[model samples]
Target chain A: MSDKKKTGADILLDTIYKNGVDKMFGLPGGAIIPIMDAVKDHPIDFILTRHEQGASHMADGYARATGKPGVILITSGPGATNTLTGIMTAQMDSVPMVIISGQQATSNLGLDTFQEADISGMSYPIVKHSYLITDPKEIPKAINEAFFIASTGRPGPVILDIPKDVANAVIDEDYDDTIDLPGYLAKPELDIDKIKDAAQMISQAQKPIFLVGHGAIISGADKILKTIVEDMNIPITNSLLGKGCFPEEHPLNLGMPGMHGTAYANMALCECDLVVSIGSRWDDRIAASPKEFCAQAKKIHIDIDLVEINKVVKVDIGLVGDAKDVLEKLHKYLEPNDTSKWIKTVNKFRKDYPLKYKKEGKLRAQHVIEEMYNLAGSDVIYTTDVGQHQMWAAQFIKINSPRNWISSGGAGTMGFGFPSAIGAQMACPDRKVVTIVGDGSFQMTLSELSTAVVNKLPIKILLLNNRYLGMVRQWQNLFYENRLTGVDLEGNPDFLKLASAYGAKGFRIRRSSDVRKVLKEALQYNAGPCLIDAVVEQHDNVFPMVPSGANLDKMILGFPQKRKELE
Target chain B: MNNNIEKHSISLYVNNKPGVLIRTSLVFARRGYNIDSLVVSNDSNNPKFSRMNIEATGDTDTLHLMLAQLNRLVDVIHARDLSGEDILQKELSLVKLECPIEKRTELLQIAEAFSAKTIDLTENTITFQIAGSSEKLNRAETLLHGYKIKEIVRTGKVLMTRGEEATA
Candidate 1:
């Protein structure tokens, strides 16, 4: 509203502020100095992370925890390149984010000048959209469009690379709010005929199962999903990313179904006559092998992105639209049906073959996770790094609401938990945020502990230190005849001292009996940030696991039995 | 899985922006499809938009998915598989052949048979330009194979519907 001319950076920040982005996560450098200077006058909070990768993941975590597009700003070249993994993680998981990278001056582009990079070109394949702004007049328009495109229609990350000179250049104060993207379509109209057909299919099926994915949570379709499940009396299973979409304690919930899925969930998937998938891609982990997944069942897939419809497993009815809208329309035509017999059969399987481990033994990672769940209750936001600990957390953590369970599911990126927990805590200051990370995965981005301390984020880190890359070691023990090479963590640092150096609280529990007491203290600690290093049994393996390339029903429950016995 | 790779003609209507072409082409590259020919220009009716015609070879299922992926790009308004439609396709090519005095008469006869025009002639080389279906250009190039060919430049295929129905 000011009549004075503004720099392109100010205009860009103003546009972002207008779009409801109040927080940004990133580091500053030379090329981005102008924008950093302009931030002094803005009301937005800029969280400075130790590394650009951490910043990007924080943004992704913030977006996943809250249903808002997280923002990231960093320098060009190495700083921009460092965010590729985080950006790809968001892209794979469909987390909404806007990455603003500072590039060299426009005149020096393609000349390989200092800190110059073709960031827009390099990120084109991974990003939903990318822009390289040369003219200062287009700053406001580009920022607005980037935010719009990032947060709509199967949301993903978008990149905007601004040259130094462009950020420093002056522009008129008048900002146009009109978005003129002729090709960008945010929502698609649902086909009512398709919905009616899907409803008919559901009504006729003797045995039906609902396979929920992260899209259900992303579209805020929790109530719709719960209503459909209750009205239809169907058992629901979740993908790894879809863990918290349906309440875990619900009687119809069959837990997560995949490679590391529960025995009952996998059994229910194999026995179902119809699989109604909502907002979930049939990735390799979920499907095992596309040819063998749900071989006896017809599938009804509903998703926002059309590309995910027949990309993996062909469905009998593929409805491409927003899940909430499609489900609302489908609910009208669906009659209240009952599958009590089918539910009885699924419940029998769930009761007979539950997720169990030996109670009397050295500390197990699963026990620690279950203890944390009991101590923290079901209201906290939980995250995990990629490893056996992640699978344990997914299986044990009981989440009752959407956006409460945040992890890098699609990308399965290591070191995502700690920083993501920080973002989640920042988004919801009143809610408790906990990150369960493995020993190997924790070291990858542990530098973000400093960020948590600096920002006074109350994030509890449950470090399951098994003295090895537990997942790979388990694989080696099972398949490679226990030939453990390069999987051992012998030279690991004393985590307590490291936490102290970062000005954070740290605790350790070496005995199995101390898990409940120590976890209670860690969760209750009102301090800024805390790390609990629990030394678990090194050889503990996640049970009810479907080995790679195996069928969904071929699970290795407990210790490895003979192949014939498993069959 | 079906392993048969067939040629597909895909037409795309996109915003006339700087990185739109690269964004569209990256989809093909990422999917491991080789673009045999590509033609891009501003739309005649709408100056704000452009038309891109891409000729690529891939399995039918993969190409079908690629069409969906291409349509997902922010700049692309619409994308369709034009191969199965009743469409007219054309490509222009200029071939420079080393024409010695002894082979001038024979080359001229071959060019005349293909209805190619002689764009430039030099002491030892002659350039022939031809515009038509890709099949016609291929045939013309094959007929001139006996002569010493110096260079060949081709503008990939551009397509339009046969009837009054517009693709957009």
Candidate 2:
């Protein structure tokens, strides 16, 4: 008879596979050597990330794209610390990710051993839940809980801190535990009372504004936001984080409001008498001043997260549920309320700002963003890394739906866009998913391209090669006497060469007008992952500046005289 | 503002989870009058639960809220509102002084009396970290007036409500 003895590692891998994990993004370590050894023989693919943050981002990307939990593994100490940013990002964005970190042996847990940091404790604020699995027998249950917590409503990162001995120790459990999530249960069921109240408010309003946020995207409520906007014939103004929630090019889209927002956008926000805020938390940035944010509006706030409902600004009518569901249900009550004058005013504002960029060459960031919106059409999802590129994408990309605009909003992690796009592409492979990243942010987790290539997931990447930390430089211009300190990149990698190095198709655009051709070629080169090194202006910064801690209404409006000259 | 009024601040360490703050808040709600400035944060190196600072205004009503809210939040394993009847309390404050070089010696002498630790010393400024009751920290601040006082960050008040039977 064939011997059926299996090591603890085998059982662990089996459990992970049983949970439907096809891949893991991580770096192997001494503590997890046995698990790594077992996985080497298993069918599961272990992606080797350049950094632990990259692994977390890959997992986050995978999760965001797939609507499933992304999995990651890292060693102890610095490895665990590196993932803090990604974890906080996931927490803020509510992305479902399961991170497995190695810990010192059970005996050394409290003894302050080498390569030991209280990882579980450090990640407290950022994770849904975490565990230190000291016993082999508890591994299956802990993992089951981790996956459950990470995937449930209010989705966020969860950590499993497994001690070395526990990972190696043998246990004879069936390992067939199903997820038990009794604490969390969230669905998009419209609250009837609030909906009726909101509908009543919407009916009475003359000039209404539709303010959409990240919550709308997560709830897949773009169609709902669109339906309401179309039905009401109301203009839509987005927060900085809500930039891509609505299609920027849409006739009714008024663009981003608050600090760093266009003057017209903020004016539209202030002018609207009735505000229909969907899936958005009226954060300080968007609100400007709490008292002045929507001083004239009869606010109707709809969001799934209840804590965000009245946290910042009070609303006339607050509805808690998934944005899509609430909007869908509210559709019946809405009766095509016309606000022609309101739409006209918003159109005027949009015309005034026009999401403008100087006519730099064809390879400028503006062309890249415009082309991305054109090539991808209204169906593809677009994500972006933090920096000038993120703001540029936010300023330009015309998203037709909610979830189509995935981004690292609150935490603003650099390497989130690419990996998230990979996840988005993986989940909806038939639909195009593109990522816009700056050279600075791209280097943070560019290795994720390997995961996409290996998985045969074709994701288009627009590397806006601005060889400086654009956002920080913008800050220096306003705050720090323009010293420009530590913002410039002296030696940047050749992205086209780098993309080619990773077995992916690469393109380079240097002229102002060649953007369309390069982008068209990239979208067509769909055999595998592709990267376009769109050489953009190095000094270009996201304008309509609202200096830090400054009120939103006080935005500089992008070199006022220059703006008038453009007009 | 009411000097004669008796005040209590309770600090607790509990598992941090969704609905924890709600449960703690519900406790106060059920008892009437809510917490004044209830700050929920994690204890250093303890990931499972957080150290919650519950500052309640009313006397009898405060106790009820603390008891009720603690019971409500599933993740909140413990809850307490400190009272003078039980437990030791500590408040930490870091004050940045705009002291000229000449007044630096006087400020240092005052800081020593309060057991304050000097955190920063510049040509025109001196910063000190003082740990004690809110009143004591305030007194130390008053003594450093000759120098320019730039900013003050008070850690608020954290209390262990008497006769400790391990709340968590």
Candidate 3:
């Protein structure tokens, strides 16, 4: 770097390479020509994506799978604007990511020049931080700060807008070790007194439940969280993204809770006298209403973000710090509790209203998930799109390790599964990566299959082609008096042919009996990407459904023909 | 509850960099806080930092949350709410009135009562400059309400604690 005159582009790419990033995802355009030109000089390999949105989502999937900030590069204007959804999705889920977009030259910034945009301005609300570099010398520090800011605290996306002129400007800049960010609070100190108070409360409580979420995984507190739960003899329930924090197969696990949650977990959360939420925010989908969510529990909210403390629901003790840090101190003052009676009640709920579906009637999504889960290896990483299939996957698939379950939980974004699966597959090339996608959700970013085929990523896609936007259809069927409009996908493309056209393997699960066979073929096909289109029942809704704004106990366990009235 | 409606003063010490003002305003706007008045200028002590004095009305809980978010901004050095502390506050207001021949003397008397100075005078109009709290400016404007007040502008409130302690 000293011998060669490095331009701003070289410095930017060098800084990224110095940060330990070997590969990045993006598409090249006019605004980013300088950066693209410098790419040949650097050792970094760039994955050419069909669209910038795919680049962002792929980066997101990579970030979630590996606990590092996923890096993305793109041009300005439409290219930068296209990454907003991915940025918002990652931000909502607290995934760490960095997006570098090329801006118009500094001289032609406000004249509405070609590919000119105020990207950092547009991304202000979605990103953790943003920088619009006017000087080439600022590139090194801006990049370093971006990576640091994106990966620290409650990890989120950050944007670095480098003008084309800045990228082409020759500068004698080098990556610096010092980070000049005084305002950012990356790590908050653990309050020992608050931990003690929370432990004391847990000890005195007769009925307690451990509600864990994505934060536990982010903080790497799974082992300690399990230790705390077992020591306190509490039943544990996870949120949608909370899977893999506590093993779903564990005897004390109550599975996921909320709108499409398991009956027992929701009941346990609703009836418990004490609720210990570690890392999980009080997301709206958790229950019928925030007012009634864990209304009886003397709640203890432990998280890394301070704003999430009294954000939605109030808590008695709010410990604003990392989950692992608080749990480490909390481990010092723990003893077993006599949970004979509460366990009996939790077991009764689990036994009486277990998650059920019509196994013998038709090829339901539940059956497909069941067969796929049974067939696929237990160590597979599952990323899902937003819809009924995502919910069914959450209910059926049981993850036992952290970072194995990736989904668009908060944003509920469709078209996330395929590209994200590509990212996850690239991140963990050794592990099996599968995306449970719906027909509606899969088509949104299905163009990325070309990226997968070209890159030769061995990603398996489980496409549940139900011919409808099933989640919205269910809402319309239940809430809007069956006046379904805009939920039907009548003229959907043949996914099998589409897969073949992209030079990827394709299979179809014709019925419940064929699920295991087709999934086994897809899962075992390791040459490149494979798509398994399981055309499930058209009107089959995911059960254990808590109607929006309804209390947890008031669940519709089955369809109307087999419905059981709640007491 | 009574204190919730009253305008809360937030003082921020931020890097004198571009987009700092927009970033600070974005935090307040997201928390649904309306900025009644704001004054931002270069910090006298250090040219590298800027001082922003903002007064707004909103719920106390959201205000605290917004402050935390604002303080976390990369350019914001420090942000603090000084509404509960004992402080000296002031504002300057300029009022131009369409004065009749006889009303000029009467308007001067009203201005004198409020310790106002006649900064401008013409055959048909007079303009008064007054300095005090927002309430005093409001009273001065009300005293000349019946007359045709041509223009009125007030520098939103600014404050500093009485003790030798930093506001931000």
Candidate 4:
């Protein structure tokens, strides 16, 4: 074998290549001049986004679209801070991304230097891990480790702050140093005793229900979740965050049990004797009143994040490990059984209050969602930007697999879907990644299309053009006497034209009949990112919305027949 | 070899901060359980929330704890147990050893066989890196004693784990 000597930047770019990262989303800077110069001659394409935030969002979208960690590069201070929202969005949703920021020279680090901010400190809470490379020798290790940490279990972002001096410094040390990080070992094995105990409770319970969450997708445990649910014949209800964990059409699947969830789904949860929560933090929106959320049920909470165990509602059995792993183990302990009564009751409620949309309109948001869901199929990885579109996707999209739906669950960041889909696409290149963004949220990271074009990632973007911030407008309609505040954007770009300018395929779906045709064409392209501007009705809203502080039992049904009057 | 396990206690002085304890516990948690009575506190002498005293069982745990503790920011100031009469226990080590390609497969087999993970390897050259208590390093050195040793660097032990009622 021939020996070849390479510079730090060369090694770094080679490392990215080895990791199968074909593109990078970032803006050039002074500190990262060496890397910029190196990248010019490298195999990886550098996407120059309009802003650092846009670049980060594109990286985020790529990561969401694929399972690979999205890579974003930026300069110090303002450039670094600009990616904060995108970083926070990925962090909240647990999307894998690597944010590489150029830092001031090591010699000027603590001297209150120019273009320097405590970046590692600033991103500490939000990132999976962080590194400030002051030595050129550490660059290879840092980059390798950042990728490892970001793409691994319970995926999230990792930021590497590369100082100017370090980037320019020449290190004589060999490039193949295998980094040993003894301090950060998070391989949690399945605790057998806890599993046995949980199995016993689940086996004996009359009304056992699986409350699936984002952890199910993160842990890659959808198969295990489905097997257990099917074997035990237990009804499964997902949190809004857990929408795609199970196929919505599954016999026992109760779609999205939360604030705006079906009345029967909420009732089933309320009445169930056993609630096995997998990979889900008991967020208030899902469990409106934790004390009363599932007072009738004994919970078996399994999650990878230890901090989330017994956080709000205390669980009878708290097995802390990756949900996917734990579920794989738990499947063995369960005996084939039946829960027909529970299934019948849930089905009855499901039939009575089935998800409905008012027809006889010019265009309905639900129609777009159904068409999109059908066009992409269950195998597609879907991401949604916050607003009415997100809720509509939750209701309409029948996600049959894990890691299928990436959204801003906790923070509800609007501009999140577009960028996170970019991140997802980069991570899982084999599957089609489609991001559903509203007219308002799409504008937030709309500049990221340039990155998509540069990288040549085929991420289908479905912009649900409502021409208004639907969620805020809904809130205003319900509470503020329909007083629309700054919820309206007067002049929005023609999305088709915008996509074309970025060198992408674009389509505009105005009539209801055109939805499926346009969506099918978008998904089938398989060449590069495609944008479908879905001109949905402006006044459409996400119904079954339980007003904040209102009881989950009480929700605003879209139609009179859809509302359940519980005695 | 298991007879060498004479429940040793080595307190590691470290920085008290969020995720610090987890960081310290992770090293031992990776290999197997190492720590016995791990205690942490703000040093009275340095009231800026500085020290941590980690006591571990088994010589391997003590050595591994010592090396792992040194990497932490708070532990940067000083880390050691207070043993009487200056036994001169310096806890710094860097080894750049070579195992012949002919014997390389066997030597590396011995290295990895003995938990000596490789750091870097070239066609004719290979680097083995390990950080732990001096005794563990000495044992590691003995295990690879037959290999051609190229270079060895050591950082002196600052102090030893304190005894009953000792401050971190």
For all the candidates, what are their Cα RMSDs to the real structure?
Answer: 1.6, 10.7, 2.0, 16.2
The digit string of per-residue lDDT tens for model 1 on A1-567 reads 366568999988989999999999999888898999888878999999999999998998899999899999999899899999999999999999999999998999999998888988888888999889999988888888899999999999999999999999988766565778877779987889999999999988889999999999988889988998998899999888887888989999999988889899999999999999999999888797998899999999999999898898989999989988998899888876679999999999999999998767788888888989988988999989999999989898877899999999888899899989988999999999999998898999999999999888889999999999999998888777789999999999999999999999999988879998998888778778999999888888888888888888778788856534543
TM-score winner: 1
Local accuracy of candidate 4 as per-residue lDDT tens digits, A1-567: 015345667767777788789989889877778789878878898878778887777787676555677898889988899999888877887778898898888888877777788787777556776777766887787788778778765678888888877776656656654755543445567789989999889988888888888778766677777777877899988887787678777978888877767677777887789999888888888876666768777999988765566656778999988887788888888775567887888788888978888655677888988877776688888888888888888888887766677778877887777777776776666777888889899888787787677768898888888888888998887666678999887899888888999899998889987877887888788778999888888987687777675556666675334223311
Off by over 4 Å in 3: A174-177, A561-567, B1-4
Provide a comma-separated list of chain B TM-scores, one per candidate.
Answer: 0.95, 0.74, 0.94, 0.42
Clashes of 2: 19
Q: For each of the candidates, give the backbone clash count.
A: 0, 19, 0, 45
Writing each residue's lDDT as its tens digit, candidate 3 over A1-567 gives: 458788999889988998888788999899899999999867988989998999999999999999988999999999999999999999999999999998999999989888888898888888888889998888888899889989988999999999999999998645454688766789998888889998888888899888999999999999998888877778999998989998888889998999899989988887899988889998888855766778888999999998888777888999989999999888887667798799999999999988888888678998988788888856899999999999999998998888989999999999999999999999999998989999999999999999999888899898999899999999887767779999999999888999999999999987787877788778889999999989889998888888777778677777666223422
DockQ, each predicted model: 0.82, 0.05, 0.67, 0.02
- In model 2 chain A, where is the ten-residue run with the lowest total lDDT? A558-567
lDDT by residue (tens digit), candidate 2, A347-464: 7877776567777643568777877787778677788899888777777776665567777877878888887787677667788888888888888788777877877777889888
Q: What value does the lDDT take at residue B65 in candidate 2?
A: 33
What does the lDDT come to for candidate 1? 0.90
The candidates, ranked best first by lDDT, are 1, 3, 2, 4
Model 4 per-residue lDDT at A71: 90
lDDT of 1 by residue, B70-125 (tens): 99998999999998777888899999999988888888888898889999998899
- Worst-scoring 10-residue span by lDDT in model 1 chain A: A558-567
Query: Model 1, stretches more than 4 Å misplaced?
Result: A1-4, A562-567
Candidate 4, which segments miss by more than 4 Å at Cα?
A1-6, A14-22, A43-45, A110-114, A174-182, A425-431, A454-459, A500-506, A513-530, A559-567, B1-168
